[model samples]
Target: MCVAAVSTVQPVLAQTASPAASADKVDQLIKLLDDPEIRALLNKQTAAPAAEADTSMSATEFSALGHRIRDHLRKIGEAIPQVSSEFMRAGGTIADDINGHGPLGVFGLFLTMVLIGLGAEWLFHRIASRSRMHAALAQTDGARQNPLHSAGRHLFAVLAPLVAFSLASLGLFMAMTWPPLLDAIMLPLLLGVIACRFVIRIARLVLIGPRTGKDVAATAGLVPIDRASAVFWYKRIFWFACVFFAGWALVGVMVALSIEPGVRATVGYALGLGMLLVAIETVWNRPAAIARPHGRGAMEWALTFYLCLLWGLWVAGLVIILWLGIYALILPGLLKATTAMARNAFGGTPDVPGSGNPVVEVLVERGARAIIITLAVLWLAFLINKRSSMFTGEAMTDRIIQGVLAGAIILLVADILWQIAKAVINRTLEHAQVSTADSAHAARNGRLLTLLPILRTMLAIVIALIAVMMVLSGLGVQVAPLIAGAGIFGVAIGFGSQTLVKDVISGVFYMMDDAFRVGEYIQSGSYKGTVESFSIRSVKLRHHRGPVFTVPFGTLGAIENMSRDWVIDKFTISVGYDTDINKVRKMVKGVGAALLEDEELGPLIIETLKMKGVEQFGDYGIDLSFAMMTKPGYQTTIRRRAYMMIREAFTQNGVVFASPTVQVAGGDSSSAAAAASTVKTAMDLKKLAESGEGA
Candidate 1:
């Protein structure tokens, strides 16, 4: 049986072996395995039942985890003492380099190089000082006159010195030669200092603006934070940067000394703890001038707890969970804060619409957010790859990480596009708000304002749907079915809610026809009012009185826009039949002339008030027609003023308005007198009754 088994396996083993292995070697291995002793051992192994794999968690595993944790803690405690030794070793190496190179030690040499770089920076600044000062002056002068221009000038003024400093320092650092150990230690240290300075300067420029001995309120800084909050953040950021860079430098030195990973991690954690404390302090003690939400105390406590939890996770080496927390909680807030800060800096006032340079604001805000999200995604990818062993397999892990990153990128791009679209739409709407007296321009602007809002809403919905589908696709989700399902659902909705569809379609056509606009007075059926605003399917009409009507476009059939280009208003007045007709025409003509020359109403009057003709013969007098053409919305006011002027002119010329009169004529004088007396008494009684009712 053993011989047969060996013969069966030999060919397979030979095929699997290296080509260098000869047929004789393979035969020899099979012959050895075919021996009685090896055969008995293999038979014993094969006869025994294999131990069932224990997949469930047991007490033994728990105990093992506890032991590992204890060991890790012990290692951390032991690693503390090694830090001093590592520093000593690095210092001794530096000493050896100094001793070999001349009396000026490596530290001193680094300082001298830094000083030279500073000298170069100073020289550059000196030569450019006049220009920078002029730029500052220009910025101050044009800050309100032209905010975008002033912002550009301020940026140039702030960046020029820093750019010069960076170029000089980096150039000089590259020109020098140093020992390998010194190079590693000093280069990062020098770069860290330069970077630290640059950050501080930038923070200063943003929070405090150009240093012209002005108060924070008077400064031209981009941020809209108060003086106390600005100073507080500025100081805190400076300290935070110092702590971070110092930790980084220390880690670099430790790495150069070949310190154990455990020791380095412990030291790094300690530095991180310090930074965490600083952050906590800043959070709790931030200037009260900064706005806070309701339940401020609870929010602070929650944030503090979250920070502590994050620190604990880092210390426990739960990098994946730590990063998840950062991304979920911290990243959104950072993005929002960055965007708001950018807007406040660029946007002149919160109340003013389209106050900022949209291009610059969007670029800075969206670009910064994009960079932040990209860096975060890349970092998470790196962490996942580093710990890929914890997952199922590298290939599957890579696919998942790629999917998540791709989804993130898609969302980021969508966000940028949406923000740009919003900016353009909002800018258009802002420009559409014209406060002009020109009827044509006013009407055009009103129409633009009315349509743009609804268009903006539709655009937002479309963009959002597209963005959601794209994001899902990036995450490896099949979107074809989703689209089809959405189409079917929309059809169902259209069938079920035909009224809504009718309203929306009607609104579109109404806007297309330019039937009525915002601020125009219109009437359709009984729904009549000035157009206050518009929504997707409805229009808000503010009545001339106090009432407001929200009428849907479908119901507003055949709109009569009263406040259009011009209105020709006609009114009738009854005059005494005995009055001279030519004299009355002459008086009306003079009244029209006076109206045309009136300061307040002249501009509104297209054609002054004039008597068209005698409208008709009335019961007691001749009714004369007067007509005037005036700008829309001002016809009533001008007409009222014209009435007052005509009344005064008639009074001065002895022209009397017609009134009801009774004339009794009869062959018998006594009978006629009795009829007249009866008529007079009846009219007097009617006047008395009306007076009593009024009182």
Candidate 2:
């Protein structure tokens, strides 16, 4: 039996190297670079010797020397072997043997892969069951009815054999003889896994009813859509990919049989191409959460339809065009349709007929563009698969597809990696407040919480850039010009906005230093307000006068913060010196008791408003100060409320008002009345009840 075509580069993996050769190679390179001949060739004199001669060689001579050196290097390069590749090649014989035969080889591979898959499922499920799921399953009222639990099992059952079949194909190819009893064994296993999947899918569907299914589906905005369905379809697509790969392997064996002879070998290339097409379709076909439901289902349906129609039309067109001698030219229409679908998938905004909703358009656009690129890939795959002896487009399409696939893979891998990183960051944040007792403090974390987003963003940008460079390199595209262009643009922007950039950078420092925080009442030059918003460049403060003052971090020179922690408002209602200090203190304490008794808003106050004796010795009476730690943003309200209450309580206690009159050098009532009337007329509006008609 033949092994399915295993990884061609597995033995020569680009990432790995052998220990013996790796060390020896490094030493040899270092030794060679330091050798007299090599050193003289590489060395450059800062200044030429006074009697320097023209030592330039003739072009022909240089060319001959270059040719000799290259030939030697090529021989050396051919001698090197990798550790991973050595093992991979050791097993490649199974695939080579299977390729020597027929369908029987394929069957052998299928069984082997199925067994491997089952082993993996058992291993992971054991881990999950041991950790958290076991306890959860026990507590649920209807554990058997829990669809989530059922879905997990269904996935494992279906994936086990699919995986086993692929691996078995590899093993049979490596270990078994050519064209052995592989297909005969594998077809049954393939059918068996498909049957298992069919059963599992139906079971999950049965658990989905009108009421219950709606709830599971409703968690979409936060998680994946059609959770069970997506899981089921993802598994199906993976199996289909395996099946396609296997079919290609069988063709490879047939081609091998006639390899020595002049049998045209286009079928293996075509099937390999088809495998790539199915793989692309499989990746983009995934269901995602539709946070904005408007046009979401339609977009998904369009994506699905595009895949099916393109696949069907390509097959049909290829057959017709070959028989009828025509290209059919359906590509433009397909391209247009895909472009529209891409735009819709990634570019739609939520249909909220209002402003200030959370914008999710960026995600949509990103998703849509990704889908379109995938669509173009499948299209190219079709073209490559259909190319004939005349002007075969395989080479060009293969390069393009390689680049596209690399980019898509990078995006996906980056997404998964970012999620893992975010989880780590969140866990670290949680660890900080694990022992905090206050409800708010228990939630507060280190400065890392703020830095986490920045770090993630920086990492994603860096990884994405690396991915882009790699994709370009894979497609043989030069990246030097692009890098140079970017550097130029960065320099230009840096030079143009030097001051604005400085302000932004300085603001970041301001935030990091905690110069000021939200909800603090502060007075700056021309701005006495409470902090409402803070950002990298500026902060917004709302004033009591009904305006928002925007202050740049660079411009805020000094500030007076009255309410950073606790504020004590001093109150002085003068009483005659004869008034008992103990009595007045007792009266104030009683007022505090009455306030504490008011259960309606008692929690808002940290402690009852209390009196401190003689905040200052006033001219006519004792000045007293009162204070309490009220909730933040309640200073003005509490101050106003306390003032009114104190006035009423003082009236009840007969506390006198302080007069700034020197019993004013004898009582002159008429002069005093005239003076008071003049002051009222000049500066204040007088509102009076009409005379009672006594006249």
Best by TM-score: 1
lDDT of 2 at 479: 92
How many clashes (backbone N, Cα, C below 3 Å) per candidate? 1, 40
- Candidate 2 lDDT by residue in tens digits, 418-477: 545654555564465355535354324333444454566667677779877877876778
TM-scores for candidates 1 onward, in order? 0.78, 0.48
Off by over 4 Å in 1: 1-74, 84-106, 130-179, 210-221, 226-228, 280-285, 289-308, 323-341, 349-356, 388-409, 665-695
Model 1 Cα lDDT, one tens digit per residue, 162-263:
677666766677777756776776667677777787778788877767665345457755676677777888898899899988888778767765778888
Error of 1 at 138 (Å): 6.0
Against the true structure, candidate 1 has what lDDT? 0.79
lDDT for every model? 0.79, 0.54
